[model samples]
Target: MCAASLPDTATFPFETAVVAGVGLIGGSVALGLRQRLLARRVIGYDANPEVLREAQALGVVDEIRTSPGEWLRAADLVVLASPMRTLSPLARDLAPFLSPAALVTDVGSVKSGITAEMEALGVRQFVAGHPMAGSERGGVTHARAALLENAVWVLTPGDHTPLTALSRARTLVEALGAAPVVMPPDAHDALVATISHLPYLASLALTHMVARDERLSLLAAGGFRDLTRVASGDPRMSRDMVVENKAALRGALARFRRQLERLEADLDDPEELLAAAAEGKRTRDSLPVVKRSLLPPKHDLVVAVPDQPNQIGAVTQALGASGVNIKDIEVLAIREEGGALRLGLESPEEVSRAAEILRAEGFEVRGRG
Candidate 1:
């Protein structure tokens, strides 16, 4: 059954949940569980004491442990939230102390290799999971429980993975307000390679191309910035992500190269370029109308604000007070004198309400209908 079909619960599913690697994803999971009351007590384990301390201070976790020990014996669920490369080693290190009933999972984007390694290590009740929600920023400071809200979380169970364990995973994922889709590990890796990893690599390449030319740097505007935003995310984590799934990433890269070659060959022909651009826009517009994807086919509005203090904050606060939800917000352009902010709402009603609210707050608003 899919996560949507799973019955929602008002009671805690796990008594003591241990999250090893209290980084952004890990910390978010910890915070979500505690905030939703999915776990009675959430314990954090991290290699860095500073991160554990920070997590506790931020109320991301109820308790912090320096290392995995007998404390894990009490954990009903264990989340391996470290870097992709470190997951295997970390699992092996904690294997001795993990309780037989504890359900183990990871939030890493890549799943095929680590799933195999975990199974080989004889980890009891291991299920592969990847939450398609996160920011490029890393660390507990940037972690928020809302990151998992309405996200697509994939779960890949190995051959020996029991139905009970998978059920438990789906329950937890749904409890965290994420939709869970179950698929094979290989399938999940291949899908993310093209959509997630390729985008990051493409953004990185674009940023590098612009950085090499000093004059181009100043000319880089909204479009360039929008295309390369992912390039500014945590480089270390991104490196591990692309490298961990290199086999699938290489395949994706080949497909992307073919597209680039076609574009390059047609650059001199205005008609062919226009055709490509039109088709590209059509395909982009057809993306799944979900929370993290395209935001319901873009109920977009642009607000013009002068270069003054609290301009952006005032606009958002006004919308908030009026019960208008902003699905996506972007700074289209900013100049010395003024700038434009693009906001994506859920529907035409929201868009209309938001524009009227912003106008009342003394901002020039326009919709891209």
Candidate 2:
């Protein structure tokens, strides 16, 4: 990998960012960057003029351009947030115009094809990134500032990728309040194929199987409904994803089929099937639960408040009044004496400010170490 100079701050390296595609991922990225004050300017380019207009009107992007080539020439960073199928062609189209010093990345779920395309395009500073975050909803309208919070953003830098650009990509993800995890492109694709792509396919199949059956719809219960909920995702996006990552998805499906066959064979033997089910439960239970926030609070602040209907709201208002942005707040414990509300802030300084403000307002406050 080529090494370049590391920037002191992630935000310092990228003065301007051009986002291609104004869908959910692209819009959310632009929004996140703006929210965190990461870039000086963010321009967007989308095939659909309406989507581009919507992004600009919603403040998801600072400006809209007709072509990426026009904006990418001067951009410090170019983020491709389009569907998987468009990634390769987009890479090819943007490669010649990309600034040599600029870092290029994408939000495509599949990486191998894009990596190959980048290689063919002779793009040396490219980094493959996939943010493991999304909602059931699609488009720029559904963009959320906190969408990437606590989410794992994977970076797969190829052999020719510059170390400077890799560091920049990590810094960019951090600025968005996301954890950057590095993995090989192939491995990332294979893992996601099982955890993400395969699940979507299964959900799609489950929903279709039931919908096509005349009797199954009436018999469907909460379990079926809940399991197949993701099937309602954008059909075009889903279709593109499945077709784009066919190899990995097919391999995952084969393994899943084998497992299902094994379970079917043991179904007649209740004891064997029961043991298998127990083993599966054990494995599932052993998996660690990922916290919702990538940047969790280092310390917990416990505040004692009077047991009242609006005590929590009062405490929050006091903190806000003191210019302390509460990261999280929850009612820890409630009693007749006073209820203990825990507030999670970004840093100890914010905690101190909140505590002082709450105390000044005549509420007992304690900062937990």
Candidate 3:
């Protein structure tokens, strides 16, 4: 569907949003929607009352529903953000209570299984979405307002999904500062198997390998730590994802094993192995970086200012007073005379505005490449 024909941006028609689970992804979605969208009310439903209360206390939801059926009846959009195992049964139970006009979607990592169940439950408006953004942290406490910023959110709409519902879902994702890409359900699963699931499995394997050795772990530094960091993910979550995407993940692992075997075979010859290692490093370094978000253009400008303690704050205040939004700010360099601070703005206009404001306030500011 064309973007213009979708829901009007002036008024978000979703009066009440029902979030089925109040974990990290669900809480973050509620917090982001409440902060950014025009929705009148947001309510949450979780099996655990403690989680429900915590979500309410954190201001992630306007109301907490003890019974999923009660709020599910009136919600305009119902999001299933539960763990993978509970998704199918929850969809079955909540299907009858959902309003006929309500649009439903899930934040589950695996899509094919849930999409089939949702279709079986007569949820014609269901769209499967996987937001490719997460931290090693878990639970509602780790939810952040900027969690979805610059993230790639993939939507896998089923054959029966209505155009109107897909449009609304896209708008909701975009409002939370994510770029949406549409793909088929199986295709989405295949891509994530290589990029997401296989990597987690590899991390777990690497961690296990290192743990089996006593001496190597003692000497392990940043390289090993960085490579195995994802192994710290919740065991239950990792297990669920691996099981759901096993077929695709197995294929990915097989391909990866062939590469590993090649390297292992070349280990007998030191010169050949060194050449292989150098080639791998060159290929890795030459790959282009991914800039995932399409919401707004960003530009970095460097400005030199005095090294005084309050100088940074003074410049920031001046920019704020001039109504300029600072996307990011960093101390790029510190010289004997002064330091250069890099400022990231949404556009060149905001950069120019900030520069003018700082200069007018008697701070020496210049744009840097």
Candidate 4:
């Protein structure tokens, strides 16, 4: 699921990459590609001329093209960042234009429907990928290059998917500073229905209920604001996501309804209420403490730690001596002799500094050019 240190190749992973839409997700990808020097040329295409112009002005893309076919024809990697409804038609339209060696992927939240459509359309070298990172804000103006850092980017590669094509996509994902995870399309859809799609609906419904009771607004505080955060996302995108994944959403809602009824029935049972509270606490504790990938970014430095003594501590101490801060450090692999540590820093500059310091300290460091 993880890349072996950013493809250690002489040539760039891709020659030309075209992002279909220059909105938040697409813009972020383009920014990462350009910032990491992962692609030689990165062009963007958008139907809205004004937004396209804005994206170009913001330096989100190197070039802006009016015709998708022309750019797609020249691209070796294409990312479909457009809305869900537009994905199917675009796949069919771009199928003929996409080069035989091209690898196409998407950032859509839903996957089952899109994967099936692309498979049917005969799009060459297509991989379904979804980056588990975003903001409530929309538009290229809000995009950041570090949007994919430390995020669990899921790639749904089926039996027919080419291993080399998936490797190319993973190269791009790793360059974006995100971990690539593989799964089946149907399983991905089913899982997101609970973790991704269901939560947004719950927030929307909770906000609506609060709005109906104007008195509740006066009592709304930290808890209410935190619960309704996702409800403030772009309406168009949220509507498209819920509608496209309605089948899974329906099942999630039905199960949620049963849970709600059970809670209602337990209103008079103190023991049941205590048990429910304990269960909620356990679930919350079991969940990973996810960090948002957009701000401050995440830069990693990988080093092979020697087994004996305080090698890990010595590495950190060297960086600490120079006043560099560490965000989150993960042990990538362990062995009887030692282990490989992936040190997460606040920015690319910090990554460079840490690598230099580690190398001076006689550590074999390999990460982030």
Backbone clash tally (model 1): 0
Which residue pairs of candidate 3 clash?
Answer: none
Better of 2 and 3 by TM-score: 2
Which 10 successive residues of model 4 have the least lDDT summed? 1-10
Candidate 4 wrongly placed segments (more than 4 Å):
1-10, 293-369
TM-score result, candidate 3: 0.73
Score each candidate by Cα lDDT: 0.86, 0.80, 0.80, 0.81
Compute each candidate's TM-score over C-alphas.
Answer: 0.81, 0.73, 0.73, 0.73
Residue 91's lDDT in candidate 2: 74
Model 2 misplaced regions, further than 4 Å: 1-11, 287-369
lDDT at position 205, candidate 4 = 87
Pairs in clash, predicted candidate 1: none
Give the C-alpha lDDT of model 2: 0.80
1 or 2, which is superior by lDDT? 1
lDDT of 3 by residue, 229-286 (tens): 7788788888999899898888899999998998899989889999998999898645
Candidate 3, poorest ten consecutive residues by summed lDDT: 1-10
